[model samples]
Target: MVAPLKVGIAGLGTVGAEVVRLIEAQQSILSARCGRGIKVVAVTARNKSKKRGIDLRGIDWMKDPLAVATHPEVDCFVELMGGAGDPALSSISAALAAGKSVVTANKALVAKHGVKLATLAEKHGGALNYEAAVAGAVPVIKTIREGLSGTSINRVYGILNGTCNYILTRMEQEGLSFAECLKDAQRLGYAEAEPSFDVDGYDTAQKLAILASLAFGTKVNESAVSVEGISTIAAEDLRAAADLGYRIKLLGVAMRTKTGIEQRVHPTMVPLTSSIAQVMGVTNAVTIDGAGIAPITLVGPGAGGAATASAVLADVADVARNVRALPFAQPVAKLKTTTKAPMERHEGGYYIRLMARDLAGTAARIATRLAEQKISLESIVQKHPNGGLEPIDGTKKSSPVPVILITYATSEDAMRRALQAVQKDKVISGKPQVIRIEKN
Candidate 1:
């Protein structure tokens, strides 16, 4: 008889507890699939006495994460304590050093210390699986690392953060301000009290780094990603996007470019009919453009205990099946070094929302600056306070007027230079809101 795969899990928080319950509840299904039973032999958490609504009887309760990682009977160590540093890092390292397979849902750890950890796993002949680190329950890691390994991937982009997506969805659907939507998201448990990590695009950047490494055979480098958050996005931007046949989404995009692999996270203007724009709320989605094939998009619930645990258990099952794949889709030594791509050199269409000073020659000066930069406007609209549009006739109004400009494909440098001239020329009231238009 084949021995069951003994599992040790650290951190009995929401995700950890759910993992245990899932293993027990789906034991028969998992066993049938992996050709062996799966068992939770050991576990550890900060608080053992807390009521987690799951039974942990017969499971060895270790004193700490390191103990669980180094447990003699554990065949696989699952790290659910989410931080880029120890003891999650140390424990995962210890498990890999011990030749026990390691699974985790820590994107930050993977983003920061992935190469080091993968090197450890390689040296010790153990598997390092972090299917839950990026998009929860999406199976994107497996898709990119194994399923599409035969295909050449050119671009990978998506809405990776549920909190930001939820906030943006509310802002667009209810016409709420970013602050208002963020407050509601917090109250609904979709956002943390300190939501800067999610809203500021850092969360998406980390996930994008992981995906970029997998897709492009590069090392995971979060610092290489150019990041911009959704905090600056306003209700007006979303409304204007609707008027212009686009939807504003916070997207993390990594693509092959002439300069190198370009990784960026920001509020992007996606066409209304695109697959990514159809996604809303807390749901996460990733679209992969590969050579010799149509684009592949994976969509699912990105967070929550059940969704994350699903991915964690899937990684555990791969260990149970004795499936050992390279951690970053290749040996760490072969993974190329990634440098930060210059955002100024990025070429794309742009959406510029300017609060133009309603004075004579203001419109002409703005147009002249863009023209000097060789930027051609695809469309331009002067928005009235009540969501109406008037021609840009340089007509003075009671206050500053909202002028929306959609430019054809242009370099970020040109757009920046033009906007700077507009600002310096005192033709705009406040900073011009700029969102890059992503081509589908």
Candidate 2:
């Protein structure tokens, strides 16, 4: 057999150690598949003596992670050190400069600096592989890069964040509020103690930005993607969504429109019967709409050491076998930025919940506002006496009852204007909780 490929690893946290474990566990299979043995020869972390739940015997220790990437001892550089810049970026630069293959699980790095990195990798004749970056173990990147190579993909979108999904699933199933469900998720270790990144859809947005560039052959534009979180998804919103033949999910959407590309991450109401709706818990799923071929979807464990490590190892094997492909499934020069259209111009259905005065004509007043905006209601539910929660204070005693309405497909701008009018009325208390519904 050819000599084993020496791999250098940086970061021994959850994903880092898993890569080592997998390399050891799959040694035989990798040799057979890639025609070479593989081994992790060096590792770097803050503390050299730290116990990372794995045996660190016989491995070389590098105090500075950047040294590991630049060292001549390894043939490939594996970067599990996440973050868009600094050690991760600089170390990756050193690897590419040395003409060594680099593999990473950093979506933030890719979303923000993928184009430049791809350019550098190509310039140095170094391979930049990141199948693990988008959706943990799913070969969505590979499928689009290889399996569906012939098709022109127009849309690449899905549920990309597991923590958010788990929380949202519990909120609907247990009829708990967002805050309650989130606290439970944190206790279960499904979410980080500081959950802003996951709950706010920023994590999903980062992954979506990377997916958009690959699927559309466009330049990475993290700023172009609009993002919304699950923070405001009330229990009533989830309950009302269920009654409208839909289920709420934090969806990362990327689509090719004539005017420009539309990218966004938000709490979306999907048809209750769709396969995407049925996907629950800490699982990541992505669906690609190929122009001619059948739409393909992949869903699986999207986080943790075991799953993420599996991805890093697969990338290691590919580089060992000289798996040659474009840095981002396309040449950098071929990649262009998709025109970015505003969210208001896009057409979609919406869910609106309001606390209004219980008096007569209040409902008619709200309906007239919707008509003025050219928005039509697909369904309306006015609870004569919504006893579950009192209408938020300050509204007139004659305020309309808790009014929930599902509007037909309309412009986002129109919906916002209509909602503004509804909330401004003294009879209605607080802003009408609104969530958009997508047929997909």
Candidate 3:
């Protein structure tokens, strides 16, 4: 029998530890499938004296994390020590510069600096495989890289942050406010103590940048992806959306057109019956649209230590078997420099909620504002008064009533202006809240 492939791992954290477990549990199956056994030859972490829930006595321990990348006994390098810089970045560069394959589950490293690192790997004949970077266990990178290889993907996007999803779903379903839901999520360990990155849409934006590169042949542009969080999403708004047969979700959405690309992360109104709407709680779902082939949807646990580790091992196995593909599934030189499409050019539907003075002239004024901007109202459902009875109608000047409406297909720029006009009108009482709707 051929000897096993030697692998070294850095950061014996949740994912690193899971990698060890998976290798042991699926050793026989993986060996048969790949024609060689994969073994852990070395490992590293800050605390070398710590017990990592499993026996690490057999593997060589590295004092400096970079040593694992260049270990003489190890043929493959696995970077579970995250962060887009420092030991992880320096070590991976050294390994690739020395012409060795690498496997990593770091999305920030890829989304922020994939192009430079990928160029290095390709230059030195080293494979930088990172299937685990985008969404844990979703294999989205693989699907786009291989399955949709020939199609012209307009754009790719999805719910990439599990922590945010849990919070939003809680707010939408339980009537809990964003802060309340976020607090609960953190207590449950779904969200970090400092949850800004996940809750404020930055995490999703980073993941979308990676997906955007795969969907469109563009260099990953993390800064270009616009982001809006659910912090300001009112509970009353969630309840009002449910009444209009919609569910509120923090969506990382991108689209490409003749004009340019529209990348946004915000609170969106997904149709109640849509497959994405049903993806509640901490779960994640990604939708890919191609010009020719059928639209593909991949859904599963977006994150977890083991879930992410499984993906890292999948990439390692592919490398051990000598199977490889482009880092962004295309040559670095082939990736088009992205042209950030302005949000004004974005064409889509919207859910608009406005509070109006209780009078007959109010709705007409809103309709006039929308018409002025070429936006048509698809449906208008005047919210019943907060109490048991509906607000009594009065044609003459009277109190203000909350009006909720959904707009037909229109440019985002137009809708923003129309909604702005409605909010500013003398007949309206408060600012209008608008949520973009994804029909698919």
Question: Poorest 10 consecutive residues of model 1 by lDDT?
Answer: 388-397
Q: After superposition, how far is residue 49 of candidate 2 from its true place, in Å?
A: 0.8
Tens digits of per-residue lDDT for model 2, 1-440? 57899999999888998788888878889999999999888889877777777877898899877989988888899999899998999999889888898999999998888888898889988889998998899888888887778889988889999999998899899889888988999999988999999999999998998888888888988888899999998877777777667899999999887678899999999998887898899999999998987667899888888888888888888899988788778889999876556898888888888876776567778888899999998777654344343323334454346777788989989988887887676658777788878776
List per-prediction Cα lDDT, in the order shown. 0.95, 0.85, 0.83
Per-model TM-score versus the true fold:
0.98, 0.94, 0.95
- Per lDDT, the best of the predicted structures is 1
**RMSD versus native structure for model 1:** 1.1
TM-score of structure candidate 2: 0.94
Model 2: residues >4 Å from true position, as ranges? 338-340, 384-400, 425-427
Global lDDT of model 2: 0.85
lDDT (10s digit) by residue, model 1, range 1-440: 89999999999999999999999899889999999999999999998899999898999999999999999999999999999999999999999999999999999999999999999999999999999999999999999999998999999999999999999999999999999999999999999999999999999999999999999999999999999999999998999899889999999999999999999999999999999999999999999999999999999999999999999999999999999999999899899998999999899999999988867888889999999999999988899767966567666787888999999999999999999999999989988999999988
**Candidate 2, run of 10 with poorest lDDT:** 386-395
Question: lDDT (0-100) at residue 13 of candidate 2?
Answer: 87
Per-residue alpha-carbon lDDT of candidate 3 for residues 1-440, written as tens digits (9 for 90 to 100): 87888899998888899999899889999999999999998999999777778778799988877999999887789998889888889998888888888999988888878998899888988788888888898899888888788888975767788998898888877778888988899999999999999878998988888888888878999888888888888888888777777888888987877777778888888888877888888888898988976667789988999789878999989887888788888889998887556778777888876777765577788889989998877777666656222332443434666667787899988888887777777777767787888877
